[model samples]
Target: MHIVIPIITAVVGIIVGAVIGFLYRKTVAEKEIGSAEQEATRIINDAIKSGETKKREAILEAKDEIHKSRTEAEREIKERRNETQKLERRLIQREEALDKKSDAVEQKAEELDRRLAKVQKTQEESEEVRAKQIAELERISGFSRDEAKEYLVSTIEREAQHDAAVKLREIMQKAKDEADANARELISIAIQRCAADHVAEATVSVVPLPNDEMKGRIIGREGRNIRTLETLTGVDLIIDDTPEAITLSSFDPVRREVARMTLEKLIADGRIHPARIEEMVEKSRKEIEQIMKAEGERATFEVGIHNLHPELVKLLGRLRYRTSYGQNVLKHSIEVAHVAGILAAELGLDPVPARRAGLLHDIGKAVDHEVEGSHVSIGVDLAKRYKENPAIVHAIAAHHGDVEPESIIACLVQAADAISAARPGARRENLENYIKRLEKLEEIANTTTGVASSYAIQAGREIRIIVKPEQVSDDAMVLLSRDIAKHIEDELDYPGQIKINMIRETRVVEYAK
Candidate 1:
């Protein structure tokens, strides 16, 4: 039992030694960790101090830069202020100089007024002396001032009238000579220089067939083909009485053209059915539009008129199917343009505007059938709607005398229209009616006042009237001619213009004769 007790004591002593060694080791480890933490804190404090120093340096630099900028701005402001003060001083000096010049001018004006007043007083005195001299002379002549003045005025008026009559005769003679020669040369040159394609009025359009057998096909079962064609084309189809040719008749030229094209296309396709006819008609209408556009472009190019409104160009193309009397309207328009241009050039006018106006003058005829008014009125309205120049609108309206001509261009347009229409073979009229009308016009002129005799000349385009000098004075003859013209205009429905010539002669016979 004693051995066991000593063993337990030895174990107890060993346990105590182990516990003290563990405590010492733990204490040393704690000391080491504290030293490491203090060293880390010292390093962090140094880093923070370095960052603060950089921030302070940046702030100091920013403040210094701001101060520098302020100093520069102050210097610039001072410089600008000095410049403004210098400019103000110069302006003050200029104003002082202007004031001095104004004062000098006012003084000169006052002196001139004083001098004018003195001159007026002198003139009054001179007038009084002249009046006394005139009164003495009148008394010596045994005539009062009023009577003498009346006789002098009468004598002067008689002499002046005689001189004026002589001068007027000379002026009229010169003007007539120049005007006649100019008109002849201009009209002749214009006619000769312009060459237009001859196009006759076509009442019937002919469509050529590929073969004789096709004509039979065109006249389908029970005449259904021809009936459908007529119904679709709005034209009468005369399929018989011709070999390999069919006639399309329509009063409207545009309809006739469309019908002709539609038939030609249907024949080429060898398809003769109602459905085919409708399709072909529609296609032909489109083709006609394209042709119309192309023709319009061609006409504009030929006339050298550009930038026409698209609608205006299309209307111009429509003139291709229009006829005036017997002349093709498109060709006639081209001719008129040429004539108007030549005449305008000779008259020292702008030829392009004149030519353009001429080309478009008859454009209203294209739409006259569809529209309510005469072509002139329609054309004027159209031109105005398109924002055309007022002169151009005036020319359009007055070409037919539907409106009063306001410009020289308008008169030129009327003259060109007349020349175009009056040219031989340009138009056709009923011979019997034309002759009867001319006879009636002559009869009417002969029946007018101051109409001693009358004769129609120039294919009844002009009438020459002889007047009795005693009954009709020179002034009365002028009035008589105007009256005759008005009567003719009101009484006749002539295609073109008619001129009236009134002749009054006064003969003074001498023994030498």
Candidate 2:
């Protein structure tokens, strides 16, 4: 029994212990669950707080963005409104300006209408006055209105015809005088502007000898050297006592030049032998040919002419040795070219053709000595052979009034040629002959019926006659001038052109105190 009681107690003790352990474990588990629940609630609460903070921040950022967008849109709208206001202001200003302009135009139109009505009334009054005057005129003339009207018309017609005739005479006379004056001025200007030097050339070339002893050397052993030189050069060597000078006389200028050069070289080299003379003569011939070509080129260059044939250029250079009436032909031609160019420019024509024509106008004279034709015909042929412009050819042919001038350029060339030939010191004329020309011009002017006095001016280029105004009527002055010019043309042999001027003036002197 004692052993059973102890064993049972031990079993009860074991069971109670196990129940307490179970209760304790159950309480620990409940506490752990509560802690886990609190932890989970805290995590949930933290997550919700974090989510609320992020949502608020996002809302704030979105609000800021919306506010910024609204501000920008408001600024844009303000700018557009400002622009619209400016446009409206400009439109208003333009409308006001237009309205003012319309009002001004309307005012001007009203004023024009008033003036038109006033002019119409004035015209009506004038018509009434003319009608009354006509009626009175008819009554006084003891005739019907139609008959009186016809008579008045005939009278007025006669008066108008007389007035028209008088006016025509005045206009014609004025035009003639102006033309003469203008021509004189233009010619004077051309002459004044021309500054070319006038060279006087002769058929003889004078060479200076080194010494009187040299002249003996030139005459050489029995004059053989002199004879050889004269034969080769075809010139007359006149070893005269003119102070160390020998004169080479030749009708041909080229021959004279060659002889002059040959003699100069012989004198310079102190070699007067026949062989040296022949060599020098041949050399000088070549030199002269080169010189002629160079001179031709220089002339064309000076005159601004180009594209000329080589043969033509050489011929032009030959004109440098030619003389007409003591005037160097080349110099005269250059002067004529300058004058023609000037005149052509003044007349609004091409100066190139004028200058070319004038330069080549006298080219025929270069070969006229060799050719059996007039200079004009030879010039025409030369220009044609050289393929010159036809107008240039015509100008060359017509420069001397040979063939009637078919073109204005030809006429210009003729006038220029005459001007160059007629300028003072251009040509040689005896003093007696010149004085006689002036006297003849004066006498011709004096022969006119209404001449109170006569004066020949401008080297007989112009003849001025003062006429009595009472004797020579204004209309008669024109007739007198024409008659005087006609008479001079018919009877006088004047060079270049002559002007016949008739002056009819009535002096009305009034003293103003």
Candidate 3:
């Protein structure tokens, strides 16, 4: 009983301690909860202050931005207003200026109208005066008003014609002076550039024999050898009294050359048979052909030309044997080419075509013996056949002034040809023919109207026509000169060209008063 009581007392003490412990834990928990509530309230207050600060800052920033935008807007509006006011001021000034200009124009128009009215009144007064003068003139001169008016009109027309003639003379003289200078310079340049040697070709070929015995051997077997040679070579063998020389005469230079070579070979070989003669002639022919080709190549090389048709080259070489009025045709062609090229270079034209045309200008002479036409016609046909440029063909045809020169190249070719042929000893003309040519030139000029006298000078190179000043006005002198030139060109067959000069002067004789 005693042990149970003690145990029950201990149990009661333990319960009391447990109760105290529970109360202590509850108090601590309540204090902690209260602290947490205080902390939450403090945190909520701090958040509210932060939010207010941010809102106030944002509001201030928005107000500042709004103020800035409003300020900019106001500034822009002020600037626009200023610009608009300036534009309006300018517009108003322009309107005022236009108004002034309009007023000035109106004043000028009014003045012009007044002047026109004054002019009309003056014209009326002048018409009355003119009518009274006409009446007086008709009464005094025993002429009607119509006759007086016609006489006055004729006099005015004469004066006008005289003035117009003088003006025309001045213009023509100025233009001719400039043109003549340019032409003279170009021709001089061409002549200076072309320094070709003159080759005086002839229709006869003289072969030097070893002895006079060779002449008899040449005419062997009762003139059978000479006959065979003439028939084969188409040339005349003239056995003249000249010692150690035989003359081969033929109009065809090629045939004459072939005959000369054939005779020379026969003399050298001392084989006088017909068979050997034929063989030698054939060899001579082939050799001459080769020489012709070589000459053609040399000519092209010298002239700096290339790409010629083989047949054309051969024909060009044929010109080496040809002659026209004692001038070597091939040499003449080369000279003409040089002159033409020089002229073309000076005149700013292509020298190649000019040179080519000039080289082939006398190509017709090569085949003229075979063809029945003028060298110009034959040359044109040949050029066309060779597929040459039309300008080149025209140049060839017009080199002799046979056809009208249609281009500058053709005109240059004509001038070059003239210069080439006009050189001293370049051509042969009998004294009789030369005198006749001069007389014909003077006659052509004298037949023209208003020509007092005509003189052909410079070996008929130029004709000077003196015109009566009273009959020929300055303008008429120009026309008369042209007409005479044209007529001379049509009627006369001249070498190179002829220059026609018309002289007209009024010499008023007045002694000192």
lDDT of each: 0.84, 0.89, 0.87
TM-score of each: 0.59, 0.58, 0.69
Model 2 alpha-carbon miss at residue 84, Å: 96
Expressed as tens digits, the lDDT of each residue in 1-513 for candidate 3 is 999999999999999999999999999999999999999999999999999999999999999999999999999999999999999999999999999999999999999999999999999999999989988887899989778789989999878877877787789889989999998898888888777876576655899999999988889888988888888888888998999999888878778878888888898899887777788778888888998898888888888788888878998899999887778889999998899899999988889988998898999999898999998999899889888889999899888777789999998888888888888879877789889888888887777778899899888888888899989877566556767878988899877778887788789888997
Residue 298 alpha-carbon offset, candidate 2, angstroms: 1.4
Over the full model, what C-alpha lDDT does candidate 3 score relative to the true structure?
Answer: 0.87
TM-score of 3: 0.69
What is the Cα-based lDDT of residue 79 in candidate 1?
A: 100
Per-residue lDDT of 212 in model 1: 86
> lDDT by residue for model 1 over 40-140, one digit each (tens)?
99999998999899999999999999999999999999999999999999999999999998999899899889988888888888789888888898979
What's the C-alpha lDDT at position 205 in model 2? 81
Off by over 4 Å in 3: 1-133, 141-150, 466-470, 473-476, 501-513
**Model 2: lDDT to the true structure:** 0.89
The worst-scoring run of ten residues by lDDT in candidate 3 lies at 473-482
Per-residue error (Å), model 1, residue 182: 2.4
